[model samples]
Target: MVHNCVFSFKLSSAREGIRSEKVRELIPDMLSSYTVNIAYHANNPDVGMALEKDAGRYKLFNSDVGLFITLAFKDKKYTENIIYNKLLSDKLDVNLGYVYENVVAQMLIAKGNNLFYYTMESKTSNHLYEIDFLTSVKDKICPLEVKSGNYRTHKSLDVFCNKFSNRICNKYVVHTKAYKWENGIYYIPVYMIPFL
Candidate 1:
């Protein structure tokens, strides 16, 4: 299920060498205490919204991040010594984007927010631009993108804001940096998510 959370259906299949249907079947208790699947916002005109579960875009995440950390180290026979030290010292050699995303999902869930994200292919290029999470702030939708680093090329956030300017209340790029407003987008630290 973590594979499904990190990679798309096709990419996960290629990486894990399993059929996509099998991935869907593994997490039977979806959106419950065991797991949660964040569905794409289908109402967007370019999204080609589909009612069918298998036809829609989604990202899976563990309901509790504490359990998730333990599950992540399952292959090591419960030996989380290396993982603990690395995380504490901030030197883990793995991609932390998924970890951040999972934590954000857990936080949002704790705050009683249903998870949803948006992704679209660029018209000029084949590159896909994605908003990590879309949350309703008051009456307007807030588009958020999570970044592990300080880089600032958030094409998806930009595109989504431009396309749905009136619908958006505040655009955010969640990262490790201090809170600041650049142009109209708010660069918020990960710890500040709960307040937002």
Candidate 2:
């Protein structure tokens, strides 16, 4: 079974090698077959179930974080000491924001939650506001903005709350910070998400 699964990916024409049109054509099958998941926009009035399913506008998440990590960094042998050590020691230069977001999706799903997120165009500038993950608790939408160790501010969360404060239950910033509540937002360590 393992060999067959590995062999299934034996084709040289993988994601990077394929034309985008062909990849777009395969999305429906990938979605329906549970090979990937689509997270809708939770800020919608229907709480992310927008009634009209738009796969094209959805965000795709890997089924599991571990698999994503392995596949993303498998350009070299795992047994190769240099590459493995850098990854293990956090010294490797890689943009892994997607992996962090994937784990959030997985954790939320494990807690009997369907994945949802929010995005909006900023009025003051050409920039956009994006809330990483949103969950419904007691009929109020809780907005979560994920940040790396070097994030400057939770600007997206602030803007999102300003627009939809009436419908909000909690504002959270998920980062490497310790747990605290200040300025009406909870700054929680990532491990505390299941309790959210």
Candidate 3:
């Protein structure tokens, strides 16, 4: 049998100032479909070591504070090149580079089988926004925006949502917090990822 799996991590103590009841409730159910593995980074070196060692095999989720699920999968050739180029560019700082690397790495792990990261020419601008990742789930193409902060306002996500709203059921804003839905877009906290 083919088993679809997810590994989750908690990154926050509360959501919007209240204790996260949804996070508490959803975590156990999220674990039910996959082989569950849990760890707290505060006390566990093993979890960090494991994540770093096989970073390609897990999907990362963040509660609110830190890195969550570490996704497992294979890397595509073109995406690897984009990541490499970004790393060499003086524009991205170390923290930003880490965020991009981790996001791309997690994406490779979660949707490696179906997605490709590419750059597409925008009709309005000669410059390109590195088309980060693409995957077809249930025959619909899903585009993802990888960002580090909890804030969800993103121009790329908005563009993708508007352009493909009919064809795409959902667009993801993967970040370092818990999931929420606003204006039909799914704001997925990195900790609660691969569930949708």
Candidate 4:
């Protein structure tokens, strides 16, 4: 089996201060089922190529948009096992949930060509916010806001929703619990993504 996982982080924040809590939550499952692959944005093609050449042999996929990976698996059952383990683990964090949201978005992109994924960058005074994922399905752009805890109205999400209401079909806030579609947005838990 082959699994392609694309993890995205907001680049507006300082690289060092951006917490690894999200990556920490994802690493165990990714490492168990398939060899881990990672990709990031590169401003220079020559530098990106140099890094890839030094990064060793693996399945690498690149595009004008950004960097990404394609993971080849020796077994499929490990997928289920890793998921089950992640559910049982109690160390999960909110930052980790945001990372998982990107993983889920990439998984959806891998499943079909009709869908397009992008990240949103916005500014408010001196503060900047980058939404985890923006997906276009059936010509409608859906902005996804990731939360690790109980679902609630978020200020950033609200701001994005209000600002892009004309372009966005509905804003989605993904969490770790159940799914709900209230108002014009969808509140979906991580486990329901494969089905959605």
Against the true structure, whose TM-score is highest?
Answer: 1
Sort every candidate by TM-score, greatest first.
1, 2, 4, 3
State the lDDT of candidate 1 residue by residue for 126-192, as single tens digits.
Answer: 9978788878766677888998865498888888888878888888998877889989889998888
| Tens-digit lDDT track of model 3 for 84-118 | 46544634333452354354445445543322333
Which regions of candidate 4 fall more than 4 Å away from where they truly are?
A: 1-95, 113-124
Measured by TM-score, how close is model 1 to the native structure? 0.79
* TM-score for each model: 0.79, 0.76, 0.44, 0.49
Q: Against the correct fold, how does model 3 do in TM-score? A: 0.44
Least accurate 10 contiguous residues by lDDT in model 1: 45-54
Which pairs of residues collide in model 2?
A: none
* lDDT values, one for every candidate: 0.71, 0.69, 0.44, 0.47
* Candidate 4 C-alpha lDDT tens digits along 1-196: 1112433234225355534455445645764553433333211212123232212111212221112211222145334445435445844232455245445655554554222222234564654343545555555566666677656855667776776667666688878777777877789977665655
Q: After superposing candidate 3, which stretches have Cα over 4 Å from the reference? A: 1-94, 97-104, 107-112
User: In candidate 2, which residue ranges exceed 4 Å CA deviation?
Assistant: 1-34, 43-54, 77-89
